[model samples]
Target: MEGFQQQFIISVFIILLGYFFKRTKILKESDGQTIARIVFNITLPALVLVTFNQMEITLPLVSLIVIAILFGLVAAAAGFFVFRSADTDLKGMAIMMMPGVNVGLFAFPLVEAIWGREGIQYFGMFDVGNAVIVFGLCFFIASYFANGSSKFYLRETVSPLLRSIPFLTYMFVVALNIFDFHLPTFLLDTAEIISGANMPLSLLLLGLYLNFSFEKSWFPLIGKYLAVKYGTGLVLGLSLFWLFSDYPMLANTVLIGFILPTSTTAVVYAIRYRYNAKIAGTIVNITIILSFLLIWVLASFVAYH
Candidate 1:
């Protein structure tokens, strides 16, 4: 308990530190992209290699990947039905933003701080399925609504997954592990050095990009997002917890996985699709704050050994 509390505090403090840097203009908003590149292309990939290289692929872990994909689809469907009456312009943004978890950049730092390598490995596997929603379905939805007549192309949507450094690293490392191939000591040592920076760099990047603005127009949309996202998460997460009380790790994964904030890709889609950027940005910022609090409460339960 004490360890969990300490790590949580450190996590919050680091996030605040990044916010301070951005608010004080020590770093510009555009600089966030540079930091993200470092985290994703370098530190994160290294972390993936270091962790997945040793973990064996198991049936449960494979199930987690499938659950993540199914959960994403369900969440998106729920959002669409819940807000079916919303204006056509706003409906697309709402549905696109509702489903996916920010499993990588947002959840990884906290998971690593609490449960170390195994936790990361679990979430990394879960993210493979979620990636489809983030890079594919959500993108397609946004584009569809943005241009009224856009068609879904598997190649176009899946391109982001193919280009993702961390995703490729995950696949490479997992393949090597399954084949019982050994990574060279020198390579693993180098990766450990780089991967050590992953958490702080990711948290710092999150802080840099955090933005919130109050708008009367956005409140209802934000409210609906909270109710749909967290509300659905709470019911499903708790049910999973009770169902698999003996398997604390898997149960907790289900809980935290659903509680994770909306994918940042939602905002990207909003902007690219020419949807209501203000509402999109507002929901993203607000949900992030709420998710931090919710995850903290959850960490108290799941972070224990």
Candidate 2:
């Protein structure tokens, strides 16, 4: 319990340190992009490789993948219904933001801090399904609404996932795990060294991207979007917790996974699809703040209990 509290404090402090760097002009917010790239292409993949190298594939782990996909689908459906009366642009933005969770960048640091390698293994499996939703389903919805066309392009949807190094790492490691194969010791050692940097770098990158600016005019829409996103998450996450209470780690992972901030891809998709990027950014920022607080409170409560 003390260890968890200490790590959590360190994580929060590191984030604030990054924010401090940004505010003090020591590191520009845009620099986060470069860090993000490094984290995604290098540190993150390294972490994935090391953590999942020897992980055993089981029904529950596989179930997490399925659950993540289903959860996104449900959230997307809820967004569609909730924003049915809104304009195409607003509707598209809402729906796009709904399905994906920022597990990689947002959840990894805290999860690593709290549960160490064990937590990473669980969320790692869950992220496999999240990657599908983020790259596959979210992209399709963004494109569909952006062009107002029903056309589906296979390459367009799969291209992003294919290009994702971390996602590829997940696939590579999972395949190896299934065949009961292990990478060379030297390779694992190198990956372990690189993976050590993922947690701090991710937290710092998040701090750099944190922004509190948003138009007051969009408050109502943001409110509606958050309400639907988190409201659905709470209901589904808690229910999953109840069902999976026998597996505390899986249950906690699911609960935290559901409440994670809107994926950063939301803003990227909004920009690509010509939706309102500012609104998307604002919603994501707010979610980051909200999720940080909620996770802290919830984790602390669970720790004490």
Candidate 3:
């Protein structure tokens, strides 16, 4: 318990330090883009490769991929129903925001801190499904609404997934595991070294991206969005946790994964599709703050219990 608490404190402090740096002009918010690129393209992929290399492929573990996809689908459906009366642009924004969780940037660092490789392995599989939703499904929703066209562009939908480094890394490592093939020791050692940076970099990037400014008018919409997202998350997440209580780690993973913040990609899609980027950024930021607090509470409960 002491160890967990200490690690959590350190993680929060690193995040604050990143925010502090940003405030002091030591690192601008724009620097977050470069940091994000490094984290996603380099550190994160290294961590995934190293973690998944050690993980054994199992029927139950693979099922997490399906669970993540289904969870995203359910959330997307809820968003559609809840925002049925909104304007086309807002509806598109809401739908795209609903489906994906910020597992890579937000959850991975904390999960690594608390549960180490074991936790990563679980979220790793969950992330595979999440990547599909983020790169494929969410993008499709944004594009569909943006163009207001009946046509579904298969190439555009599929291209992002193919180009994503982390997604490709997940597929590569999982395939290697399935084939019972191991990377040479030297490669694994190099990957392990690079993977060490993932946690700190990710936490710091979170801090760099933090912003509190938003139009006051967006408050009601943001509130409703949060209620819908987290409300659905709590209902489904807790129910699944109850069912999987026999497997404590798996249950915790599902609970945590379900409630994670809206993906940073939500803002990206908003910018791409010309859907009120300021409001989208505001929504994502708030979710990060709320999810961080919620995860801390959950961690405290887990520790004491």
C-alpha TM-scores of all predictions: 0.96, 0.98, 0.97
Q: What is the descending TM-score order?
A: 2, 3, 1
Winner by lDDT between candidate 3 and candidate 1? 3
lDDT digits (tens) for residues 1-305 of candidate 2: 88988888898899999999999999999899999999999999999999998898878788889999999999999999999999999998899899999999999989988888888989999999999999989999999888999899999888998999989889999999999999999999999999999999999988898898877999899999999999999899989888898888889889899999999998999988889998999899899999998899878876775
**Lowest-sum lDDT 10-residue window in model 1:** 296-305
Q: Residue 292 of candidate 3: its Cα lDDT? A: 94
Residue 134 lDDT in candidate 1: 89
Model 3: lDDT equals 0.91
Window of ten residues with lowest summed lDDT in model 2: 296-305
Best by lDDT: 2
| Sliding window of 10 residues with minimal summed lDDT for model 3 | 54-63
Q: What overall lDDT goes with each candidate model?
A: 0.85, 0.91, 0.91
lDDT of 1 by residue, 99-204 (tens): 7888888999999987789889889988888888789878877877778867888898878999988788878888898889989999999999999999999888
lDDT digits (tens) for residues 116-199 of candidate 3? 898998998898899888887898899888999768778887888899899899999988988889899999899999999999
